[model samples]
Target: TKSLSSNFIKNIVVEDLASGKVKEIVTRFPPEPNGYLHIGHAKSICLNFELADEFKGRTNLRFDDTNPVKEDVEYVESIKQDVAWLGFEWDGLFFASDYFGEMYDRAVLLIRKGLAYVDDQTPDQIRETRGTLTSPGQDSPHRNRSVDENLDLFARMKAGEFSDGEKVLRAKIDMASPNVNLRDPIIYRVLHAHHHNTGDAWCIYPMYTYAHPLEDAIEGVTHSICTLEFEDQRPFYDWVVRECEMPATPRQYEFARLNLTNTVMSKRKLKLLVDENVVDGWDDPRMPTISGLRRKGYTPDSIRAFCREIGVTRSFGIVDERMLEHFIREDLKLKALRTMAVVQPLKVVITNYPEGQTEWLDAENNSENPDMGHRQIPFSREIYIEQDDFMDNPPPKYFRLFPGNEVRLKHAYFIKCEEVVKDADGNVIELRCTYDPETKSGSGFTGRKVKGTIHWVDASNAVPAKFRLYEPLITEEAEEEGQSFLDHINPNSLQVLDGFVEPAMKEANGGDKFQFFRHGYFNVDPKDSTSDAPVFNRIVSLKSSFEV
Candidate 1:
């Protein structure tokens, strides 16, 4: 975490400390272990960890595993890895299941105080009776159960005497209240599924609305922060703490969640994409999950800096995705190694050069940073250039290779096209060029200059590699009123090309990143690269029109 910036949350914390309302700050990030964490979760993680760090306080990582039907140990482990990869450590690790016994006792206390009762209505009946926004809900016939009867029924419900959904405990709040959340909300239900944390110890589970507030209060949290979608639940959150007579009172605050253009942040939709095989997996490079971004070559420093730049606010807005690409390019400009790669190979034969001969040329690893030093590249009689760099019929002001044009090779002598070889289909397959030895690069011969300079690889020592280019997974246009988001999936999102790169890159390992001379920054694919051959995934383009 870096220094605290000027934001609404920081201002509240500052005032709290100045007025002696809070002696020490304690915050937490509570995530349900049902699916992988997405980029939206990254904002909450940064806000919680950095805010506590700024005040010399502590933060906890807690799993609100209230629903066991969808929870798994696999998701739990992935969440832990994502947080550590983001460069932060939790002071304490906890789970909602850790307080199951205490939560049960609190529910019993509610029954004894006549604040709750056991309702025998089915799930459908309960929802139907819950009135609309403009009307008041009717009271349940079983709302007046005696304290003794309610306790006995609740105990039997927890003891596995009843089937799932046969009985439920509900708080006896006013159904006529304007807020629908206070309309006698369900607190506990019978679920016969085995929990990932407590196993068969629990047959009935508490609802998330009931478990969340108790978890925060029991942990002695000073500030409970969440997204704006949960703003409506804050009233019930406070009601639980007050009615249960918890020793600590934790206040809840809501901030706007992160939304990015051309990306869906919903975990349900992302899980569907993984389950339906629409993507490779949760870690697919095109997905917006943290693991996906990590596999795509985003660094921790860049993500943290972006979160800091966005800041915390109460208003909702969508951020353009190009802004994120801008930060990564800035972070890597001086760090990534600069090299040459010909992704679309066009064969070229230097007729005037010596046959079966090669020479080594010196090139800087990264011209922007001098301390990286220079590297050696082999130049031979046969070379490969970009297929797009040649033209059969030259257009006006075209600077690349043509019938009578001369162009300088990146680090070698100037070459002029003399002959073009065509195949049966009239497609130019090869070019025969002659080099002027006096006009070699790095020499003092500045007699003339060519308008075009292209990068190439020596054919004798080139390494075959696979290059993957990507576009936006979702289309730029907004969806129509009645169309599904899946209808807008781009069919041409990924394009794979067989290419050749410098021999020095043959030994590059997974997670290594580099910048191709005219291409973009790329990462060695960790999932598919081997020592004999390498696969590169383009991180982002070399330039963008986005400002700040």
Candidate 2:
């Protein structure tokens, strides 16, 4: 795991610890259990956990599952898995539901203190009276309810006396407050839904804005860090904690959330895609969810390193997506086994080579990593090469195979194309070539030279496999006017093709990563791949124009 990068948060943490302001640092990764955690969340995960670890502190993995209507246990479990997969061990496992009783008591105390009341206004009415940025909000008629009356109504609301949306518990803050968030925001709402955790124990559920602060303070989180969108809500967060008379006070801090090009970070939109089956599921290789990135062959090391390099800042900008791809390549460069895979195969028959004999040729596993050692590849009379590596009519600088063209076979002898075997309709199906055994690889022969070297799989012992090539699910980084995000979905986001790999890959287990000779880095599919027919997802291509 990479060390947490220095940022404003780290500096604040350092100052707090040095001045004896905080004896022990405590942080929390609070995720709403509504959908799968995405790469955007990964940034926050790294920040919270690594920050606490750096100071010899503790971080809690907290589920902010206040909205039962949208939250689920599946999401809660997924979040836990994603955090652990990212290499973090939470010091405490908590849920907002754990403090539901305390939150209700706090609301009751607010009612007794005349700091909160039950607002009977409809949802639309409340929204309308909340006024826009340029205007002051109008006060509700019930805003002046006596503390005794509010207590009775709130108790009834909690006892299921009212249907959903009949009455809402609103803080009796400023009605004409310039900061609209403080304009008597609703602290609790009546929602008649079964909670995944609590399960219909109460009809009145506390709003996230109210429950979040109390939860942080209850757990003694020294610094309440959150994304910038919540920055404006910081005052309200403070108001809740202070008015509730929590024993501990936690300061709120905000940093910019992650935004990446050609990626969607919103959970609402991600859940929509899953519901509509636009992709396979939340873990589809194309989605930006942490599980999706995992299924797509991205290593935690690469992701953690990427998060560290990005740094924590309040600046808002879209990070180049290529920068992410660059880190994955660096992470897997010398580690992944380099092998040969013929994605679109063309049969090549060595006419002059021995007919029924196969020989084991030594092939370097990784040219750049000598410690990886070498593996023997089978060579025989027939092999399968990529269909794109040949052309009937050569371009000006085409150095690959063509009629009568000589090219070196990787880790083998030189071969000259003697004849092209095609179907009646003029589709080139096969090539008849003759190998020059004198130019065998590792022979140190310098008599002849060839500009092109191509990788091939032995036809007799090749493993039949499928390769899935992926592209950005979103075609356009920015949605144009008059189009929804769905309209910008790429039509060709995923393409599957039959391929052949060396016999050694026949036993390749799911999640195993390898670098195909000239194709790209690929990961075996964990869910669908079997020994009979292995499936590989192309992680990335061999060459890229992106640089760190």
Candidate 3:
């Protein structure tokens, strides 16, 4: 229940409240349900909902489903789930299609007032005539159609008497204006496709540029927040509400959209990644989509905290991806259960210990948070340690399991490597070691000290697990001029390993997260994990050099 930090958008709301320019502020998170919501959308979601909540105002969750070609019920439901998972409940749920009737009435009013007309020009022709930044646009030949004729054609177009793309209704704004968006923008178009919400109720649909403003007005939205790319369209947004004489006028504000280093933020590009199987699906942990992050073990609190730390601003820049990783590590450090998992196991035999002997050693669940209590771990004659922990011939300052070197087994006793056992291929397959009973962890023994401490699981009770290590999904630098973003797809983004964890973790349910001692934080994959065999996705490494 933390309050949002101050930002430009918050400042605007404060001034509006003090001056009584608005009685009660109303905000909304309106997403076009064309694809899955990504991390970039999380920033907007937190902004609108948290801002409204902080002000004791109401926020609505609305869908701008104007284009039936791309929108679907699946995207709508997924959006709702993402919002809820992020810890917000909207005051009202609505869709733009809910006001199609009123939108048609507004369009008719535009035509009647000589502010709009039906154009027979093709989409390509309209685009060519829109003009450049320094050049003035040419007026359409059909711009001066009679109001009665325009209304009649529009009605007929809605009645399905005309084919798709045959004609469109455009606002009669200044064609010679410097802002190209005001140069007679299309407000309505003929789309014969069936809508997911409205079914076949109407053949004609309003354009997003037109529907967005009216939807805001209809919902009594005091401030329409959007990304910086829509700054130019603000002029048209205001013009529509003013010229159409909407009872409620909503003002639009623009803020910088999120851009992350080594990742593409475009939904179009993400959809392509999904369609082409570049990823397993939208929920692939390597993806930046909200579902992907959730499946990868990111907590809602971490994401919300991250969004707040970034703050809101009009300036644009790419955030270092490490900053995000830093937040997750901070969020999970004290909360995740501390345990040992050998991702690449190398068998170590305590050569002098009695055979068939297993001792349960005490280990702290979370040393930083003692309230989490402690658990017992099995230590036995045969154990599995990381294969990387041992070396036949190590360099100077090498502290781990080299022959004749001593190291402490975490929560157990100090052990010295006596011999190395290798396969015929000359690969070290196992190690023979000796443990000193006097050097057991927490035994208050000052006999000696070792420079290294490594974690291991008793081979007798070790549960087989699958550990997935992840790297950046996009390996190359940000896209260069004329290069496709897909060209940078990291071939080694995911490295799966067959490993073993403590027996206590066998019953860990899906979504349960843990810290694998020095390995890192990991989560049970909700989609692929089963009760019998658990699969862990490495959420992040135990430590990072990334500073705030």
Candidate 4:
């Protein structure tokens, strides 16, 4: 119970109970069954389910399936999986289509009471009639239709008597209402597409505004929580519920939706990217989708931590994407095991060590987690180091490798750069380094320190692996507001390279996580990894001076 007190949703419920307005808290996460759930949806799921948990109440997973053209069972199943993966359980599952029959009957009742009418105007004509914010809307010719004629026409419209959009049932509200949404909004439209769950049970379907409130009422939901964009439509939502005389009246509350920086959260924009094959699919690791984040080695705890840290706010705000990366890196720091991987390999020959000779060197699995113990890595005469680790000419701040400069080879002996071998194009082809046998790591040698340390893998004994490096999906922070979101797509978001890893990594199956020494956290890609050749996706980089 104390845990619930920390979340703002619980605080709201406590006030509701203190005021004696509600005996139990009830909430619902209503997602349209149209697209794969993304990281943004995770925020709403945690809020609804966690609030219900705090008050010992129930939360329902409802699909607002009003539009059959864009809805699908595939999306519905993916949403359920994503919610469950986020560590939340729904007390019930429902659909707007379940109340379609009841919703249709309510429309007929409204028409009979002179509260609704059947409009024969085309979609374009209705749009032209509903004026802009500065102008008052004009009434449709069918607005003054008699109650008896309206009822008969609506019933016939549902009985396959009206072509799709040829006729629509609209509420007889004031056309001059400044709110715009309350101006005789359409309650039901004729659509012939087959419903995912309801099938071809009816040719008429209820609009989202008309069915959302009714769905909440039927489920006995006490509080209908939604993003702020729906605030304008709330009046219409409430009107339908009250006129229908539902057994219970559900209240509506609005909060700002999550707007993440450097990423687009709109499903429509994400769909465009998917259709255009900008990335891979909806679950590409570069995507903001929940499944994509999971595959990218993001823990549920990190995501939950991110949401809890931001909490619920009344005003809109953009959360810095770095905050999310910070939590992820923090969570994986002490957990992920450490290994040696050379992404951009360069030959480093330990000339002093015997040729064809190899010795086992002890390396801690995770420096932050000592209890994780240690693993033995092979140290041999020749190894592969990072290409950037060595430089033919050293600058003032370049502490890595240079001719006549010494650096420690991580977990092995300290080596001084004795010579630099070059190629025809003037690229440094190899580093001829001489090792100090007495200055090996853990040898307890006195005053044995190097300016820098670099990671390496024994070339002959190492395993060939694939390294996938990723960057921000968008190059610019906020590209022109009115332009297509894709205009800022980062051309070099992902760069795949053949890399060298320690022999111990050969035993890892797909999905294994590791922190490559001096590199970044990485995970065995669930796709395109096998026993002999592994593909590791860079999870996140280690905190360095660059981040500051």
Candidate 5:
């Protein structure tokens, strides 16, 4: 395993160990089972798992499944797959719901100590009284109920005596606290909704903020790392742990979340896309979800390298999406097999070549790495070149195929276009070319040279395939908090084309990657492709101007 670079979190772990304030380090990747994990979550997963791993400490994969309304077993399984795919093995697998019994006891302890009380206010009334940044919140009407009454009400609320949102348990902290989260934040809410984990075992669920610190404490987590939005909630986090009298005190550290330009990082927005059928599903190649990236042919190594390169910082910034493209290109350049595939085929007839015969031409798998060796590609009297490779009306510097223009066929002989066959509408449909035997590739023929060398596949033995090209699903950026994200949807995000690969490509299994000549690196579509009909998803282009 590669050594992780020193960052602020790593530095803190080092200091904590050296100072003897902590014996052994423990971190947790706590994701709520609401939706499929996104690329942004990848950052956190790397941070938590790798940080503890670097110091030979423990890390846990915990699902904070408090809100039953959005939690699902599907999300839980997807998260487990994503974490494992990222190359992490958690020391412990846990769920916040696993500690529901203990959490309920803690809430009772708070009530008996007069630190928490059951508030019989509506969610709207609580929000209305939750004063602005410049003001202080008003006290709940039931905040001063006798401890005996609160204990009874809280027990009844747990026993299913209350309807959803009819009553909530709130900490009796200062209502005028400058930090809004410390202003008597709700600890428990009566929700009769069925939970994916607990099922009907719980009619009252603890809010995430209230359960998060407790879960960390119960698991002996030394550092509770989270996004910067929780920076304000740190006070309340400590309050719950301290007031609940937990044995272990876990400190929360906030880091800036990843924000990519021209992409939606929010899970809620991503779910909306899936719900509205804007894309295929959670694993649509165009999506920012980790599964989507995986299905789009991204290697785990590339993503991990990217997360490391971005580093751990508390400063907010928007990363250019091209930077992500750059890493995938780097990862696949020498490794991916460079092969010939015509995405948009235009048939060509070799008039002077022998008919009813096929020639296998030698081609290197990767020019940058000779150890990858070479493969023989079929060439014949009839071949398919890209439609864009030929031009009926050529521009001034156009060096590709045209009437009377000779261009070298990649790995084959030099061919000159002699005629362009057209249909009734005058649209060029085919080309008739003549090849010079003396100019056969690797034949030591230096008598002639062509400015253009274009890739082609033998039509007689071509492997039919489907290609899916993807762009950012969101074309522009807007405030997603208010549903303006829909305004930036990119209509041209996905383009599907029927293509043809070399005959040998027909044997490629799903998830196999290849660098098609003149096309981008593509992955065999794992979900839709079959042995007879392969589908390729373009992962990234061959090159980009973006640099590290």
Candidate 6:
């Protein structure tokens, strides 16, 4: 099989095919059901699933749910949904807990063969005796137990005869090996907590290192793909599979994990962001969770494109945030509808229009897609424009608004700022503008070319809405050295603006996407939105050209 590109993992797979070392590619995405999938997981998911699909193979969705202390059914369902949302399907869904019985039997096999023993040392004592990277470890007194004694003790441990953390079964590997993981690693331990999927049927659980390879073998997975952090553990993984005499051995390949700028991918840190109420919840628009991205108006195709562009590699680096925004902008340009919203509104009165009469103006739904068609927007004598679009005094290069300055009202007629009114605080309260009846947009407004054009909503037809703006969650690089991720928490990642929009916005249901003409990309929030009071979340700013 020829690889699509030069990624090291793909190269390895190609060679495997050419050598006839493997007949069909089999890959698995094994994630612990501890936290919701973030952007990093998207990369891994795409890599394994895409490769398998390309090679006419299949991918398995396996939950490494060995640690019941933090795993739950809620996370399991979330993982499944996220994977499916990413446009991938599992050949079969399996759990490490599902194979606990066979894993325990394998441990018993190793014990009866005098290849393993139960260690009673405390965790700290074991750690201290394990020695350092440059030193050799001393053997434990319990390491020399007879095969029958070890088998009896291990069986008794499984029958609920041992307390949690009191004893652990370890592989009788070389104690003086240079690699610490090869120095008699723990294969199983007594975790008395009830499993989420297996329930209280068993108290003894196998360690991750001992279970992962076995699961892959039993499923006939040809390749076990994971991040670079597990490169060293591959040896121990092979040892477990080969010694257990599994029917087949699956090779493990390593790639660099995705690290993005201005975000934290650590599960523990993300949990803090949720528990502290720093944001609304896990699905907060500012969060990096899959649900958060979905709520923020990000399309799955855009995320998939990002993963495809980033490619797979053993070399690691932090990807720029602007690249993500770039793909999102490219995706929404043709999909989200266009509308006029007055975020910081300033009153403007068209003195020439009829006082009591209102008319409907035609507006394009999406300029990029002609088939999307158009809608009628209300236009009246009184209107509201952006407060920052006007100036009380004239300034150079300011084309928006000023006394005697002419500008076109987007989709409407040309207007001139005739007068300005001030309040008691000496602040510009209103702008009195004069409109030209003959200069209506698309109605032969060709006598003069307006330097600037602005968006507005009819005062009588404006709908009240809640606008949410988001910034980066963290100010520092995600993979920076010696820097605490908490130190970079942006105090103002989210700011809510009580603003107004066109009356058509009032009919918008949750999950509808729209662009606030020259403002930014926004979506109707599925949470806390209704027909009367629409809540909009800013997906990304149009002005933010995040250059690397």
Q: lDDT: which candidate is best?
A: 2
Residue-wise lDDT of candidate 4 within 269-292, one digit each (tens)?
788889999988887788898877
TM-scores for every candidate against the unseen true structure: 0.97, 0.98, 0.98, 0.95, 0.97, 0.96
Kindly give the number of clashing pairs for every candidate.
Answer: 0, 0, 0, 0, 0, 0
Q: For residues 1-548, what per-residue lDDT tens digits would candidate 6 score against the true structure? A: 22357367877888898899999999999999988888899988988998899788889999999999899898999899989988899998999888888898888888877789999987677778988899998899999999988988898889999999899999999888888998998898888998899899888888899999999998899999989999989999999898888899899989999988788887778878888877678788888888789888888898988888888888988898778888788888888888899888899999999999998988899988998899999898999989889987768999998899999999998889999989999898899999998998779657888899999989988998889988898876654688767777888888888778999887898988888987789989998899889999998877665652
What overall lDDT goes with each candidate model? 0.90, 0.93, 0.92, 0.86, 0.92, 0.87
Q: Write the per-residue lDDT of candidate 1 for residues 252-371, one digit (tens) a residue.
A: 989999999989888888898899787889988888899988878888787887888788889999988887888788888999999889999999999999998999998888989998
**Evaluation by TM-score, superior candidate among 2 and 5:** 2
Can you give the lDDT of residue 328 in candidate 5?
A: 89
* Residue-level error in angstroms, candidate 5, position 347: 1.0
Candidate 3 C-alpha lDDT tens digits along 368-485: 9999999999888999999989989999998998999999999999999999999999999999999999998888999888999999999999998999999988888667899887
TM-score, candidate number 6:
0.96
Task: List ranges where model 4 is wrong by over 4 Å.
Answer: 1-9, 477-482, 544-548
Per-residue lDDT, model 1, residue 438, is 95
Tens-digit per-residue lDDT, 115-159, candidate 2: 999999988899999998899999999999999999999999999
lDDT of 6: 0.87
Between the candidate structures 3 and 4, which one is better when assessed by TM-score?
3
